[model samples]
Target: MPLLRTNTADKFIVDRRKTHRNSDVSRAVKHTRDRLSQRSGSPAFDRELLKLHARAIVTGASAIPLLVLVIAAAGLLGGMGGTILSWALVTVTCYTGIALFARSIDKADTARIELAATKRNFLILHSLSGLCWAYLASLGCGECQVEQFPVIKAVVLLLAMAATAIIASSLRGALVATFAAPVIVYGVVGARYWMPVEATMIGLLAISLPFFAYVAGHLNRSALMLLSFRREKDGLIAELETAKSMSDEARRRAEEANLAKSRFLASMSHELRTPLNAILGFSEVMSNEVLGQIQNTTYKEYARDIHDSGRHLLDLINEILDLSRIEAGRYQLNEEPVSLLDVVEECCHLMELRARNKDLRIVQQFEASLPRLFADERAIRQIALNLISNAVKFTPAGGEIVVKVGWTAGGGQYVSVADDGPGIPPDEIPVVLSAFGQGSIAIKSAEQGTGLGLPIVQGLLAMHGGEFQLNSKLREGTEAIAIFPRGRVMEDMPALPTLPLRAVASGGRRR
Candidate 1:
């Protein structure tokens, strides 16, 4: 019974886990979709985007200083030495300030971040960086004749614009804020030169600025998508943790209830039996007139009725206790070698008078030469008694019951009791097998029962490593079979060959 309870609890946990997992996934998906709908231009999204931008800035801070050094070296080779070197110093200082600001923002708590004020400050700093780049772009190499300087300046501006687009992509307008001034300054200065190379550089800057901005916008959307996926994952993990906690709570409650039931039954066994025994004993004495003859016939009849009721109540109590013990895995078996045929025959004989009173016939069929089964004798007797009594109780007057004990095809033994009673519906079979559960037919029958008989029989059979099956149709009778496995069938062993006593004595003398 404990095993059955554990299995039932495990099944429920598995089913509930699947159900909750599906619900959690659906809820997470719906929540993500709703957030996505309101994502663009929302204050909450802006704060998150700012945080991403800060993290990106801090991560690439080292690379920015290296790129500035390389650009400074290239400008010196082109003979734009002093002006280019001064711009590099200012650029590095500006980058250092931006990196420190971003680091502070990244280290601050998320809830404390003011999106509007922080975004305004970030754009102002980026514009300063853009003015530095503009200064570098407008620098001219007048001392040396370097025709490739225009190409070098254009390439440097383009690389810087692309880098800004990538690093500040999470913030919506950071790319435009950084490069818009540089593009304008470069185009204005190049138009002054009026040469083919400068004109081409101006046109390229004009086109590439908007292109990089568009690329940055796309990257920002990708970051939002990535954030949504991460939120959903965190939500799922939280849901699973909640489900596990609920499952543990449910199992704990079930265990507590089971323990309370066992304790109640344990206490009830003595509390109910003591009074019932007194009732039965006194009622029997009054009904039989053991002490003195009862003068009133009505009083005697009343005493007899009391005795019968008490006996029935006692039987019900016993059956309940037996079932409780079996379910709690406390029913101990006193195993012995016993004959299945003899057990069934004794049960039929005990139930014979009850069947006779109802004018029912119980036909017993036994297979001869059956082996003794190694099982609990009392449990086997109870199994046989329960089956036979159920048949006699339910079988209609003049209806015939067939009791058969025979070998199974697997060399095991089985006791089958079939009755021509009002049959149970197929759907109610499981209900009938449960403790304290009765089918409609059993409820409507003239003799009502506590409904623990078949359950007790099944429990006993399970203890013996056996099986119980009930077959019935609506109009046809019900057949109950209790099968003992082949392992429980004690087969006879062959005798060993004997040697002569004189030869043993002669061998002992020689030794």
Candidate 2:
């Protein structure tokens, strides 16, 4: 009978062990599913989430030593009984192992591990820690006569649960496992005692569980939101970087194309000029009858027309080349102290004949006390000529074209050309300022030009530390002002010497 009983007991123990293992496996599968269902994007995010809980596990390990000290001080286990001390030591050793495992996860190369495996390992370690804490709770204070000793034990259990809920809250599975095990053990001990105070304490602990779980859920959501926002910010920054890279490449290509165009024009300069010279010379000879008189009068008129057309085309080519050189940074200015008044007067005189031919009057206004401008003489003359020419060309027959040179309020000088012509529209100002972009009035007028004038003026003034402004109103008039900045204006004058220093010295010596 004894041998039969022994065999039966062995079979029962084996069955119980198999049942426990199966239950653990089922619980683990359920835990993994619950945790993964709320997974956010990115494997890196999951790794970070798991690492946070792992840190909590390590942090909670500190509670074991504190519990041992508390039990020793209070004599809760009858002056630290051998069984209780051994259990405490076992708990401490297990927790230390858990803490080291967590540290390894933190220090391990994240690149080598799969995301799913990392989470599984962390969860496994956490569940094992919860089991250890649960075992501590199950160590009933049955030997203690003091009723308050159970309360102390209860307090320690609840404190451990609270720590887990607060720290590992970002991962729900870890939070639930770490706290639930201790809670169940506490309930079992409370039921065995069946005292009013113990029941009341157990009820309070149970009620606190749901509240902490809710807090855990809320914390998890907040962390997920923050991670999402970080991902979005990173994506936006990457997109902006890519767009900037593309823009820089396009700009580089555009500059290369422009440079090639400039080089081609510079190389073909002689070829273009040779044919133009032949056209002009041959047309002039035919028109003048230098070799022989043309019998037909119509042929002589056509020859004159050809000569004029050739000269206009040649002038257009020269203007294009000059503007190209300026844009290419190859145009060198011959700087000097130039009389602004003289340059304006000469340009006005040159354009006066054109104004008179179109039945327009030229009006000049000069400030007598204007100072000399330190600038490129050729550039200043070109600036004045272009303005005066545009004013004369656009002004209506019998209209007045006013040219003014004066001192600015800031001790600088200015040249303005105002014409009584159809003005440019405000919206078209940018269009007119661009290269080869003509205005509506210019296109309709008989004196339409290549539209390079304003851009050239703007470029030239930029080189001189000056600015060009155009003010106009439809059907009223147009005024173009070129302003030289105060820095370029010669304000302080050097005192003139009555005689050379050497001459004065020689005269003094002779005396």
Candidate 3:
């Protein structure tokens, strides 16, 4: 067991040394790969890199004066005049370089060549600055009085190394060079003039060198990752903007096409109605044999078929025109005080014959106290007519449909049409409400329609600040409701009294 322990200890020591050695070279290799492989080719990236270095230079320039004061106070300057001159030269050069580089990056466009040159110049400046700090830390201690505190000198040197590690961390190459140059220079000097206590401290400093490099490498990697993420976000935003522009263009074209179609339909209304009226008139006469008796009974039957088909076609055309007018925003309403009962009763009466034809029953429930509505009379008629028509059409043979007109709990009036038919699926409610969209059951039923009824109802109600709702479940039934807002409800007014005839005559004579 002891032999196994010794072998394990030896392996651990070797692995640790290997890690340290790899860390020393890892900074340079990783930095080279990061720059060469992930070259963003963005001018903004280059500009940002320049700005980071400029900030570091400016920060280092600020610390120079404070560092000089501390060293002078500690009596660690080997030659005070020489040390002060060197600090002034380095500080002035660093500040000047910072200003010039920052302005250059701002004013000049950054190309590939310019970016490479900037990186090279920055690395050189950072290396020279590191050498100056090394000189101050190593040779500056030559004239330190033996009585002066050694801890102060050590503190100043370590602090300078730590600050460099932090300040130059944005660029991996610059960070490694800045820290390594000073440490390597100092290590050589310390080896040349070694003492018992100082040698131990120097050895410790050497051991910590690789750790600082590793930290700077991690910082650089994090910065690159952040930049990459930002670039991707910007690209995504650009793509969304392009998509929005294309969508807007497509929508505009669709509107133009719809407008053209509406205009064509409106123009053709006169042409269509004139021939249709003539055909309906002539066909009805022939079927009834009003002018003369028909020799062949088949002629009368054919005339009846022609008349029915023409009437149905005319109804479909009228519906298409009405929907077009509503869609084009040209359907104007003449508002008036209208009785809801009158409109609903008239529609139910007109649809009664059609309901009887299909052997379906329509039940009418009207609230006697339901208030009048201030709305377009013709529009109300159309709304009721369309709802009753749909109910009668969808309700199965021998099925019942209910048409209800009453005041809602919210003090508004509503018209509801419910039928026992193959109801719409919940998901198809929206589809049925859309223009020219019908439910699957309605499509498969023998009586197919143009499918514009519900949408027309919805649009008209919307114009009156009202709402439309469709509630249904498959294989059960469907109820469509059209509600008017409270504002549209017309309150009842008291009737004015009339005076007696004799009193009115006496009053006129007195006047």
Candidate 4:
């Protein structure tokens, strides 16, 4: 419930509630639909579509048997490879029927392989019927004992051939799974020779009827199941997409509100600063005797209160402005040639009054040979001032604060600000660098701040393609090392005009 963060928090809560409601409703609907689909034995597939496939399987099966028998009869008459050729044709017909039936049955939620086998099984009965025919027709009058083959001498031989075909079919596919081997074994032995050609062939077909029926029924059921689920799947996907669009719109509105919040902070802060500075400035002048003081201690006390209140308000305003500038992406730095020595001297000078007030000693060691860093002078000063101020604010009275400037091993210069402050633990380092947070040491130190200074320094450093690091211990000291690339800070040198003191003080950021 922080002021700036309140709107985002509210939106997040609302979004969560909406998401939960949608999820609950979707779950309930899916559960009901799924239960209904499972309980109803109603065909999920289109009746017309499944009927089309059943028609094809039954029709082709009935037709192919006759053609294969004729072909096998031709083999018996004069063709040597007639049986094999007929078998191949029957196999080819089975495969073709499976391929065509697969497309039609597959429109439903049925298992593809099982349906394919069902179609093939429907066709396989054709070959068996043909085998029965060949054996029966070969028993022509029993006069021609073709090749001295006894089984081929009578119409009664149909049973033996039929049993052989059934056993062969049991070699693979669902037939092996559905029919018992012992049944084929017993049928071939005792019951095979007990019938004439016509009776034996017809009986063989009757025995295969049950297996054929099971395959057909399963194929129909699978196709219907697939179709039913297909409809449900499409419906669920559409619902999900609609929900996603709603969630995206809500997110977009939340972002717009956040942007508006950033704008409000920016405008209000700038306006507040104009009057805040006047209050602090005139208070300073009166306290310094630049304005004649009234001869009363009460008046002096009131002036002190006014000065303190104004300064505190100014600090709050500055934090808001810097944070808002970063949020709005308008925090541009002024690039100029800056001497490292000068930057260190200026930051130290600014922090000296604050340091002396707390009896803290800030020791600076400036390198004379430090090169001119090409970057924003204002940013460098801000970074240095914030770091030095942090160092002074955290270091205990009578402890040392060491500020050192030199070139790093790389071309970039290194400015290290160290202090014998109550230091940050390794785990707490990242927490301090986070926006709106401070180090454990800083929080417990003599001065309090808005927890913005380090983040501002880090942001300004990133603008220059520079880097910074911190090294410290729990009780020893903390060191902030800043590295700026060695080049002209301003590569695109726009002609800069010399500014008067009042304009510089008014416009350029002082802290």
Candidate 5:
């Protein structure tokens, strides 16, 4: 049980550590939202369904103007036949982008959302394509005879494409690729295609390089900070919830213990008062002869019975007080030389009278050669009395109760009380020794009991340098054993003779 408890505790600590280390709720929710929102076209889709398809058709149609120019450039470069191949490559690339955009409308596409990064990448590629457009348009090419469109339109398109790329992505490699645009614009607006505007445009794009880097670095740090705060807040919320649950469980356990304690206090008070009330009032009455007592023979017997009941209640209270002291670590033992046989004989004799009332017999067996055990005399006597009394209390009419004493060859004495009665059940064997516990068979057959008899015996045994053990079987019998160590085994062993029968309190009798 201890090992299992330790393993469970270790696992809980490991799990709790993970709970603090990991981001739990909000991060997971945010990630899921990112997955859902990243899909659907344009990175800005108001009505994802209608605009998704319309955007695809529009982007595909728009690619044809650039594709036609690229093919015209290829015809000039590869000498006529390569136009068809260039158009086919442009068609394929356009259709692929269209397919990705179209896929985002049907359902959330995690793969297609990643393809949005491809779209970002295409911006740099488009910037390079714009540089080509500017170069080809600058020449009086076969397809377009308009030379004015190259200087004005081509340079404008190249700068716009480069600026579009800077807005789309922060990746240094891709953004730097847009530098091709300024070079192409410089050539188109220069003297052959002749304009002074291209030099000023190159100077502006050169200044924008450091500006782009500064902006990208700032946004990256900001995004990293946001993610870190999200993880911290999520962990804190999980910890707070765990602490709340622990507090609730502790409060619930305390409430249950309090209820049980209240019931116990009430029961003990009622039980103790019943005998004490008679002892206080009647002892006073009999002493004063208020009822003209001491005349009839029955009067003496009644007084004796009341006195005995009160003393019995006092003994019970003392046992309870002793248990409280032990729990508080305040109980101390006074050691003396005690005979196991003498205490056993006395408990048997006291129980004999009680047992006879139920038509039960009490028996005692002692070894003549039994060695004396060093123990606390008062505590040992109480242990014997508690065990024998419980046996007599639970046994049926005509049942036999026996007390036995013997010595171990290894220098210990054993005292045992056995009864022929309905014994404890298997399930409740350990519980039979606990405070305020009784076995299933004991409760089933007996009417009234406080369930503290064996517990008192156990406490008294512990006070000595001894131990008490209980062994029982259902419907068979029970054997309660107390084993004491003699001589060298005793701690705090004071030199004193065994406590005689006369020295016991008036509650317990000795023959």
Candidate 6:
């Protein structure tokens, strides 16, 4: 017993060839999609946020040192020059250290940085800077006759808080870490004086710190949202590139496989046909007793069977080669002006004998005086023959097959073959049109076919810039139409002008 029947073996081979490659591609796409769908707080996203924070700090590094210098210059007018200058040097040095640390972080690879440890170090540095500012806020100039000195100090702190909020927005809690101590210290020193102006300045400092921190939190959320968008965009681009590469590979492989198949068929055609021709000729001669008389009746029947089967196999091979050449774009058309009505009529006549043998009626309906079509005569004949032959093969005894040749609605020529037979199911039309694909009716029927007829017809029509349509319904009938475009319809040319005999003679004498 065979493990696989012929058709089953063919199907198994095709599926096995396709399954592994298709599954691998689908798995890769699914993995990419899942990886990209991770939430915003994933480690990758956190690293991106840290990198943004480091960059922001480096960008605004000079602002703090400049502000300290300006404050120190203002303090000289209040006769507290030495105290302010000394404080300025300390503040500037602290800010320079913080800036250097931030720059180092920005230049280093994000993958090497530990997020928790980096955040902790940044907060510690910011708290130290806060202490330096707190000391400045506590200083006073009572003997210098600068009446608005307390207000000036409060205004400077407010400016510093606002700047910190903007610069450190990407890192959560950074603004609060840098300004919380300063606000507390300023409020404490003002409480000692207990004057109305001092109380007001302290109240403003306390209120402004939380306000700036709230703004910084909002800015941090915005930064995270922006980073998420950037990450998603990059993921989408990567997915597209992967899909494109897979598509290109599949197409290239398909082209190579097609080329290999074409070459095998081209080389094997001659080899196969040589033996088939000898078999067919010998079988026919033996069946007819051309050389000698046969003794047994069984021998004669076997010879006839060999001839018939050989003929069928040869036809199948020819059909396969024709379809293959058409698919590979190697089938060149021998084009000419051919009559649509005449070509279709000839095809109907050729199939009429088979129709008669099956007890089926073939009716021809051709339009009168149809224009000639500029097309490959052989291709057009094959189209008509395929359709008509299918009709004859499938139509039951006493059924009718109509072969119509006429004008299409698009001002083009068309050949339509319709049969009153057990029709194809609508869903199976596509299968019937595919190469080596047979419909259920064709498979179950006694008629033998290689299932290359309709596909070859379609490919040939396509080469001629035409279209083939199959319309069928179960238990109703089937109709196959081959339509030639209006461009292929040859128009009548104007008559050439006739010259008088005298003018012709004068031209000949001049020559």
Instruction: Please give the CA lDDT of all the candidate structures.
Output: 0.85, 0.76, 0.73, 0.60, 0.58, 0.84
Report the backbone clash tally of model 1.
0
What would the per-residue lDDT of candidate 3 be over residues 1-511, giving only the tens digit for each residue?
A: 0000101111011334444444634664565445445543456665565666556655565565567566654442544556656665674566466556655554554443366777787787767766666665465344544533333445565776666667666655775555566566666765675765557666666776677777766766666667666656665565567668978999999989987887789778878889989999999999999999999999999999999888987888888888778767888989999998998999999999999999999998888677789999999999999999998888889999998888776788889898999999865666777767888888998486878888788778878888777777788987888888899998888999999999999999999
Rank by TM-score (best first)? 6, 1, 2, 3, 4, 5
lDDT of 1: 0.85
Q: Write the per-residue lDDT of candidate 6 for residues 1-511, one digit (tens) a residue.
A: 0011111122111434454557866886687667666655788877788889889889999898899999999888768969999999988888888888888889989899888888888888888889889999899896688877888899999999999999989888888888888888888888898789988999888888888889988888898878767867887788789889988999999989988998899889999999999999999999999999999989999999999999999999999899878877889999999998888888888988998899988888888788789999988998888888888878889899988888877788888888988888855666777778888977887398888898888888789898777777788888888888999999999899999999999999999
Regions of candidate 2 where Cα sits further than 4 Å from its true position: 1-125, 140-155, 191-204, 492-494, 497-511
> Could you give candidate 1's per-residue lDDT for residues 219-300 as a string of tens digits?
9999987776776676667767887898899999999999999889889989999999999999999999999999999999
lDDT of 5 by residue, 309-390 (tens): 6766666676666665554456677766666678778778777777888999887788885545666777778778888888
The worst-scoring run of ten residues by lDDT in candidate 4 lies at 1-10
Comparing candidate 4 with candidate 6, which one achieves the higher TM-score?
A: 6
Per-candidate TM-score against the hidden true structure: 0.79, 0.77, 0.73, 0.57, 0.43, 0.86
Query: For candidate 6, what is the TM-score?
Result: 0.86
For candidate 3, give the lDDT.
0.73
In angstroms, how far off is 29's CA in candidate 2? 39
Model 2 steric clash pairs: none
lDDT of 1 at 101: 97
Rank list by lDDT: 1, 6, 2, 3, 4, 5
On lDDT, the stronger of 4 and 6 is 6
Among these predicted structures, which one has the highest TM-score? 6
Q: How many residue pairs clash in model 3? A: 0
Model 4: colliding residue pairs: 45-224, 108-226, 108-227, 109-226, 109-227, 155-197, 374-488, 374-489, 375-489
lDDT of 4 at 211: 54
